[model samples]
Target: MNLYQVAKTVVYGALSPIYRFDVHGTEDFPKEGGVLVCSNHIHALDPPVVGILAPRPVHFMAKEELFNAPILKTLIPKLNAFPVKRGMSDREAMRKAIQLLKDGNVVGLFPEGTRSKDGVLKEGLAGAGFFALRGDAVVIPTAIVGPYKPFKRLKVIYGKPMDMTPFREQRASADVVTAAIMAEIQKLLDAHK
Candidate 1:
C-alpha cells in the first residue's frame, strides 16, 4: 500500500479502539467513480475520521488557513487535502475538486462550509451542490456523532447516494440542491441520535 493508505489504515486502527468508532452503511459507499461525500462538520476530526472509514480514498477541501502550518503544508497534501479559501467562491479550489471528481476520485466536503462550534448543525453553503452539479457526482450524506472526548463512542453513518439527475433535469438552483443535501444530513444525524 502507499504511504497515504498505510497512514489511513494505521490511524483508523489506532483510533477505532480508543474512540470505539462505529461505521454504518459502508456498503452504500460507491466502490468506484466520482462521488461527493457530504457531512455535517462538528469537529476538526470529521474529515480524517470520515476519510479513513470510507471504502475508498477521499480528498477533502480544507480551509486554506490550515495549510499555513509547516507540518500541515507537507502533511495535508499527502493526505489528499487541498486548501480552500472560506467565505468566498474559490473558483480555483472548485476547479481542482471538479477535476478530481471527473477523474473518478471520491471528494469529501462539508456543505456547512465551517465547523459547528456549538455542535449544532448549520445551514449548508452552495459549494457542495455546485461540485455535485458540475461533476455529475452522486452525493453521499454522512453523519458523525461523538468522539467529543477520549473513549467516547464515535459513530459514522453513511446514507444512500442522492441522485442529482432530477435537479440537473430541472436546472435546480444551487440553493435548492444545497438545501436538499443539508436536509439529508440532518436526517442522518437525527437517526443516529
Candidate 2:
C-alpha cells in the first residue's frame, strides 16, 4: 500500500469505533479509471470519512487556509490533499485535480464548497461538474448523514456513477451540470431520511 492508503486505513480503523460508521453502495465505486466522488459537506470529518471509507484512495481539494497551518501543511499533503481557494475558481487547484483524475485516481469533492453548519445540503458549485467534464470522469454522488454524537451512527450512502458524457455532448452549462449533480445527491439524502 502507498503512504496515503496506509494512513487512510489507520485513520478509518481508529475512527470506526468512536463513531458508529456505516457505509452503503461501496460496490458502486469504480474499480479503475478517473472518478469524481462528490458529496454534501456536513462536518469537518466528512473528507476523512469519505477518503477512508472509499474503496479507492481518494485525493481531496481542501481549503487553502488549512494548508497554511504548519502541522497541516505537512500532514495534509501526506494524506493526498491539495489546497483550493474558496469563493473563486483556483485554476491551479483545478488543474491539479484534473491531472489526478486523468491519472486514473479518485478525486473527492464537496460540491457545497464548505461544511454546512445546519446540516443541510447547500447549493452546489460548478467546480465538480467542470472537473468531471474536463477529465471525463464518472461522478459518484455521495451522502453523509451524521457524526453528531459519539457512538451514534454516521451513515454514508454512495449513489451510482453519473455519466457526464451526455451532458458534455449537450455542451451543458456549469449551472445545468451542477443542478443535475445536486439532484442526485438530494436523492441519496432523501433515501437516508
lDDT by residue (95-151, candidate 2, tens digit) is: 999999989999999988888998888999878778878987899999998856888
Q: Which stretches of candidate 2 lie over 4 Å from their true place?
A: none
Question: In model 2, where is the ten-residue run with the lowest total lDDT?
Answer: 127-136
Residue 103 accuracy (lDDT) in model 1: 93
Runs in model 1 deviating more than 4 A are none
Error of 2 at 27 (Å): 0.8
- Poorest 10 consecutive residues of model 1 by lDDT? 144-153
For candidate 2, what is the total of clashing residue pairs?
Answer: 0
Q: What TM-score does structure 1 among the candidates reach? A: 0.93
Model 1 per-residue lDDT tens digits across residues 56-76: 999988889989998888888
